[model samples]
Target: MKVALKIGYEGTHFSGSQIQPDKRTVEGELLKALLEIGVITDTETADLSSSGRTDAGVHSVSQVVTFLTDNPRMALPRILNSKLPRDVWAWAYAEVSDDFDPRRHAVRRKYRYVLNADEHDISKMRDAAKLFIGEHNFSNFAKKDKNNPRSTVRKVEKLDIRSQGPVIKIDIVANAYLWNMIRKIVSALTLVGNGTRDIEWIGKMLDPDNYEEGIEPAPAYGLIFLEVQYDPEPEWMIDNYAIKHTNDFYTRESNRFLVISTILEQFVMQPEKGQDLD
Candidate 1:
């Protein structure tokens, strides 16, 4: 039987999503768990694959992974969670056809970037984000592959910027993305937000054939692969117990980070408005 699982992970310690020799990775951990549970003897025979690839330090809330397994009963989310590490968990699953390819069947991919809104002009960033809503050549905003170069033109179905408390959230929906596309877009939008660049500069970037400028990608830690949409969505079986466990794990992680952030805030040096510095 062919099965698909919706997995989530905190990618801080992972080298990346893909498997690498001598490096700890998300896929490596997942395959290890699968092996430990006696799901499959090898990766190739199982036909393991994932919806998309995420860079190191980039997190995900909804990543789809598919594989062929003879023992479907042992592949429950909660069952898998028992052997999987705390940082990575499977919360939902579905029975998919043998020919179903997660990446090829995906119609839309959504990503979210959380950024500190301390000095950014939210209005300017929103305006700049709108410019990326339609189809355009994104060569300037993406890192091209030399070995297998593909078209840089891609359509942005939605690009929204919202502010909450001290952070701003940037949500982007697209058909597909070129390498480093979202991070570069975030870099450009942030530049506009911080008043380093103007809206015209963003417009010029879309026309890479006429105007071109290198854009450094934003930090991968800020990016999150939120979800992937398919034409005929899978009837995922939600594992309530698995989800509860995931929430518990997240709560612990959240509290730890909150404390660390609070401590770091106290260490930030700032001068008083009327104080003179020698």
Candidate 2:
């Protein structure tokens, strides 16, 4: 049987999503858990694929991963959750077609970058974000993966910037993303918001001739894997409404943090101004 899993993880503790030889990673931990439960003997026989690879310190709310197993006795979510780390959990599972490939079958991938802008100008950042919507060669915005043979041109369906108090959330939906693309875009927007870079700088980076010299990648902690979209629904799954509710809960939590952050920023800024009066 082939199972499709909806997985979530706090990437702060791991090296990254992909399996590393000696380093701790989400994939490594997951495989260990599976192996402990007798899911498969080793990588040579086990088949596993992830929707996408996230960089170190990035988090995921809904990540899709697929694995193959011949064991009929295994109850996926129950067994996997028991053996996995506290930070990583399997939320949902389903029997997918053997032909289904998590990476190739994915229609779209969504990513969100949450930034603590503090006193930065959000309006300016939004203006800069407009430049990212549409198809473009994002060589400047992503760390070139020397192993990847595919073209860097990606179609971005949406790029939205919204401010919830001191935190600026940048939501982007695209067919695919190159390595470090979201982080680099966030870095550019932050620089613009801080008045260090203008909109013209963004334009220059999009131009293939000038791109390499113009952009810098941001830190990895701010990015999150928001979701993955597929065409036809797969078989052997839980109710779709349950998944929707789970995502809604995440949105509520984000909003709650925004409120607290706004209050803290105001309190901190006021005391500094009061000191000058004294």
Best by lDDT: 1
Give the per-residue lDDT digits (tens) of candidate 2, residues 1-278. 77788888889888999998899899888889888888766765668889999878999977888887887346366567778886777777788888999999999999998888686798998888899889998888877667866787988899899988768898999999887888888888898999998999888888776556646677788889989988975654554554554566667877998799888878774334434544
Pairs in steric clash, model 1: none
lDDT of each: 0.93, 0.82
Model 1 over residues 92-137: C-alpha lDDT tens digits? Answer: 9999999999999999999999999988999999999989998999
| Quality of model 2 by C-alpha lDDT | 0.82
How much does candidate 2 score in TM-score? 0.84
Model 1: how far is 144 from its true place, Å? Answer: 2.0
Largest TM-score belongs to which candidate? Answer: 1
Q: What is the Cα-based lDDT of residue 45 in candidate 1?
A: 88
Clashing pairs in 2: none
